[model samples]
Target: MADITIRLYIGPSSSDLRELVVPAERPLGDLIIDWKKVYLLAEQDSQGEMIRYQLYRESEGKKVPVDPKKSLRDLRFQAYQELFLTDACHPWWQGTTSQPTTTSQSKAPGTAPLRGPATSKRVTTATTPNPSPSSRPLPSFSPCSIELAPGCVRQIGETGVVINRDYLLRELPKSVSTLERTLMWMRQESRLLAVSRSDNGHCSIVWKQSWYLMAHHPVYISGTKYSRNEAIQIEETVTLLLGRDGWPITIRLHSTSITR
Candidate 1:
């Protein structure tokens, strides 16, 4: 039999989209498994994770399931139909799927099987204002010599306290914006990561490879610490450093006197 080709779209309906092609004879379930591996969304749970998918005929409004038993050739799916797949937590919007009415309550409420952890709460940190166009660029300096002040410190389980904000505006590089863009890229590249709070009290944006810790209190230091008043500056700086380095750094608070 001629190799059949199947296209897959993985991500939010709005943005951060991705695509891949697979053998047409592949089972729908196996295709989803392959996608999760490629995207790093295959988080394991006691029960296997559920993946929701939507398969459509090219250019047509209607959607149909890509059954495992049925070959893609049999489905007569067009050259390019919209195919969306995401971890169970991020279910594809099934406009075509009908929801059973309350009157037909065969299953108990909340008894339905869960796919993954619930969607994370969105955090809306205030953005720092952009510098005026007339502002002169600062001279280049080594990132190592620039000592970051300890940010807000919240104790972790027992041995650790995380520093959140550590941005220093005056010392920051002109290329800092590039760092922000890089983070946006990282977030898209790694969809499994999410914003979470560590057991102690530290808040961070986490991914498979690293976590960006946030300050519990603004940090104030020059030479020794970056100023705390510039919350946006600190966050942007930390984000840039972590994103670029591809390694995790621990922000520590030595004394409780630090201001929140």
Candidate 2:
């Protein structure tokens, strides 16, 4: 069967965003299984049983419920399209798992910036405990949601860091040099998580108390080759795994070079 990856964006309209990757060919019912394992959203019902979830289509700014019996192949989504699913009844604000916004900030000139939803809330140690004096979780960093794009070659100090090439070539805007620079800096500063090759030659990372997997396509850099297909495979594996948790996975091209 031809392999394909589906990128899923999760979280809320205000804050808390995450991404998941799933196999395009999988049955729609698989999304719930994946989400629960990855995000830990599956809470026990009154009888102490895991609750089921339903997937929905967000079309024309309205949420239309969908049948789990359908195959994702039937949906025929374009790359980087938005899709959503609903879990058991939770607060409206709490239920929102993802939101898409313009890369640029929405701010007025010559004015103090508006505080995000997280900052506006009364500080509670139960929800927003201080990690440290210098380190606190930022609203932008949702471990569940990921921003997928083609990886780019960036210079960090003396070393060069390369991300998925197809993603940069296909998804990233050519005019966004500043954004690219910022991303490079984040990676260099270790603020951005790395999915490097492990001793087993697999790319993976531990996220949200679980081990999520990754794969890199082979690209030749300075006569050295990195595997793109392998990376894609790793991403596919992650999607299938996350699907068992009742969540959707989002995959964007991180590199173009299949053999570089």
- Residue 155, candidate 2: Cα error in Å is 66
lDDT, candidates in the order shown: 0.34, 0.36
Backbone clashes, each candidate: 9, 64
User: Which candidate number maximizes TM-score?
Assistant: 2
Q: How accurate is candidate 1 locally (lDDT)?
A: 0.34
Predicted candidate 1 versus true structure: per-residue lDDT over 91-171, tens digit per residue: 333221333222332322222222333342222223523243247343222121112324422233222233222322222
Q: Give the runs in model 1 whose Cα sits over 4 Å from its true position.
A: 4-6, 13-16, 42-60, 87-90, 94-260
**Model 2 regions more than 4 Å off:** 3-7, 13-16, 45-50, 88-260
Per-candidate TM vs. native?
0.30, 0.33
